[model samples]
Target: MSAANSPDFPMFVSVAEARQMLAALLPALETEWVGVGQGYGRTLAQPLAALVSHPSATESALDGIACRAADTLGASASAPAHLQLTGESRAGVPFAGEVGPGQCIRIYTGAPMPAGADAIAPVEQLIDDGPDAVLVQRPASPADVRPEGGDFRAGEEVMPAGLRLTAPRLALAAALGHARLPVRRRLRVALLSTGDEVIEPGQPLLPGQVYDSNRIGLSAMLEECGCEVLPLGHAADSPGALQAAIDSIGGADLLLTSGGVSMGKYDFMRDLLIVQGRVSFWKVRMRPGGPALLGGWNGLPVFGLPGNPVSSLVVFHVIVRPALTGQPVQTLRLRAGTAFRGLPDKVAFWRANIVGGEVHDYGKQGSGVLRSLSEAGALVVVPEGGSVAAGDEVDVVLL
Candidate 1:
């Protein structure tokens, strides 16, 4: 028997242990090629290499006079070295002639370097001695020249596989002359929020009714994780309703259901998964998100999330996100701006606002408090039995 079911261990598991189980059971997603312009937010399936060297040849980095460094050796305002200007080079146009002794060529930014020239005398430092000749106020150095293939070389690896594409990555791919990028196809996730009290946002609210916020909120989160969301609507706290809803999830890669996973009498999803689903209920040792279960239903992976607004999103961020996106949870150490209570038995992930490198709690750290998660903008991590005094260092994960 698993430790989660052991009489000594009770009904919960450590976050570390749960993640191990999840990693071993999760399936790899499929991949496809997409236009480089449309590759934002997608994970790369293969490594990308630069097709051609940037600045394929030696070019000018500024609009200046290109002359041999030896020719500008004693050139200054009082005793300026004069050189004959052979021709002007700008962008695609290049001065085909070589810059001989006592001669210079006009070069613009990104223009190829003329033959026999190694230094650049910027226009601002030149005496403008007419179109045929110019006076140098200062000596030019070779540092002013932009060497060939300066930014990157051809055949060099630009990006490795499994990297999530961003705006900058897309720009790099386009600059590298790539037309398409091989990326993982967005996973199709089916979501259902369960509870008789939950109703759609537009509907009129009764005395005990709550708006159906999880369905829409979770969908947006899944999209940010690069998944394709399939909204299955909401279900009541009934076996038949949830069963029919699960049966209707056709072609979805994963299943997510909020509510009905706790130990309450109306927790039909917990009882249904125990009876029919391949995976059983397993709580995590964390406040607000301690009520979470994972397993498979009809060969489909299922994540049963808590109903409370903050709790539901916390579970998604700490667990379901990594399973779907293949990204590990990353946190940083920040000083606590104020005192935060500690849980003796479970780890506390407090919704706290970060200011000037310190973490501060955003109102009460309750499961049902949605504003805390919104206003805080980050989750401060306090380990089991570890309380934070003011200015104490704590781990935090920005949302």
Candidate 2:
């Protein structure tokens, strides 16, 4: 018998236990180089350092005259400091001449300060004195100058490995002189939804058949977790069909199946895994997703998620995501907007949204209610035997 079927093994494990168990079995994703512009949503494979310092020299942060801070000391609107406007500077065009005593340069945002200039006098705070002079009405300090290496310096590490490259991060890399980035390859998963009653949308539905909502929801969520989903569509509840689907998982890092994990006669995944595959764990001790399993077959990890759309999503968030990606689902603490209770001996994830600094649970936390998952921005966690009342603080996982 497989380990999951062993009497000494716990058929149902705690959420933390499930994660820890799976962690040891997962492999580190490989990495590759991709253009920086196409790196969005990809995880970095190595720490990246800036190649060159930004603003290589002292520059202006605003449209203003670059001046010696000492020149404007004690000056105000009533008694302004007057200086000769020797030259002008704009982005990528610097004034080549030096600013001597009683001299300043007209500069726009991001222009390097001319030699000997130590501050900026904003255009709004300066009086244009004809074509060759400016009057600064306020005191200026070195603080007004955007110093060299202010944003980042050469050789400074700006990004660490395993960080997902979002738009801002990609922009940062691009600004730091990176034309391409080394990012982890997206994990490819073969997804199959089992059940004779399940059909894809736009198909004619029979009396008992339903649209395959689980596949749609899980596919999108998997992509959000940075996995490339190879959707195999729905499979009939038969061993022959199931085995065929499993055989087609070639080249995929994982096989993700929805349904067929429960104990009913038609449920074949858990037993089939025990008989032909190595089952690490079969069930998680959590509400809405207790019927979940993780194991390996054909040298690829298999994650059997519950068929109910919400339960499938919850399982993915609570266990599969971090286990597969090595990235934690982000979490935050929010106050409960209304009272709620947890499962007697299991952890429960209630669909919720943050509003006015409080958690508003979407109505009905049922496994079948896909709408709850759709409308929620977060999931409020309640431990076993725990009860939350108005204003009660609880940890929630962001969706």
Candidate 3:
């Protein structure tokens, strides 16, 4: 058989082509330093380091008397020796004078320890505490005191660039005295749906018509990827309508459309691209979403997806998402519990559910079956000319 007639035909492009296509399309936007509390899901633009030494200075970790550990080593509860209290120290305050021998400073938690003090004797372990002197109830150790820079060092790198500032990470940055964080600009994506037979959800569906779902679904997924979605709404199934919608989204970095790309009579998306932009490729050797479209419009990337709900979703995840995020495509292999009688020349993606570690294939694996796509946890990827027995291993692409 010729290459085209082979059961496992390959349509491959160089990895460099894929990477360059992504880079040429997704140019990084200007960075902004947003408040740390509002920086969730944003990629960090610069590394964050501690502004000052943690603890800032020597401090006490407990409400106690600051004293030299050696002086209190032999003092016991039963027969305690007295030490004069020079003064009291609270949080954010430092003892004004140094502690001398036979003298201690009253210190609270987080207070800077007075000079000449090596440890803290907790309040419960002290007796007859007055401003002048106090008696020891139990001996204390050096471990009771928290020294300067105990938790973190000065000028230490806390979080590096490219970090997605989550809630806890923001709090940590705030604790390190970072009021604002530099983060990558959000990606702007334009969403459009095309079809005369499709109507918006909640609108009355006439005979031979269905609700338009791709726009809502794709917008949600794009937002989850941190993209600022500019929804251009639905475009009618006509060359003029498609061109008008494309023109309206001229400012977007990426343009994503559902439907009107297949080799059908009313496939205006391809014709619109031929007229307005460079059409790189019209189709891929994949099932469900084989009739995919990749092109550029006014120097921006445009992906024309199949109108069928499952096909649109599959192509979006497997091809479009990775292309937009500049990430590598991942694949997996597993057992195909569903029987395949014969293998075809094209790779197929079947809706499947994993039950008890076994893949159970769903019936009616049609491109328009949005219900099946919603129910499926993964797509069983059957390579060209591949077949599977009940317990045989198969490749799967997790949705």
- In order, the Cα lDDT scores of the candidates are 0.85, 0.85, 0.77
Instruction: For candidate 3, write residues 1-399 as lDDT tens digits.
Output: 122232232233232343355446677777987888888777788898888777878888899899887778778888786888888889866889998888898899999888888888999889875658899776766887787777677699988886666778887788788888888888899999999998988987789998888888999989766788998999898888888888877568888889988777788886777666766666676777877766788887887788988889887777776766555556677777777433366667788888777777887788888999888888877667776678888777777
Q: Can you give the lDDT of residue 180 in candidate 3?
A: 88
| 302-393: candidate 1 lDDT, tens digit per residue | 88899998899988898788877788888998999998889998888889998898888886888888877777878888888889999899
Quote the positional error of residue 162 for candidate 1 in Å.
0.4
The whole-model C-alpha lDDT of candidate 3 against the native structure comes to 0.77
Per-residue error (Å), model 3, residue 266: 0.2
Position 56, candidate 3: lDDT: 79
Q: By the TM-score metric, which is better: model 1 or model 2?
A: 2
Candidate 3's TM-score: 0.67
User: What range of 10 consecutive residues in model 3 has the weakest lDDT sum?
Assistant: 1-10
User: Top TM-score: which candidate number?
Assistant: 2
* Clash count, one per candidate: 0, 0, 1
Q: Which pairs, if any, clash in model 2?
A: none
Off by over 4 Å in 1: 1-10, 73-83, 123-127
Between candidates 1 and 3, name the one with more favorable TM-score: 1
At residue 267, candidate 3 shows an lDDT of 83
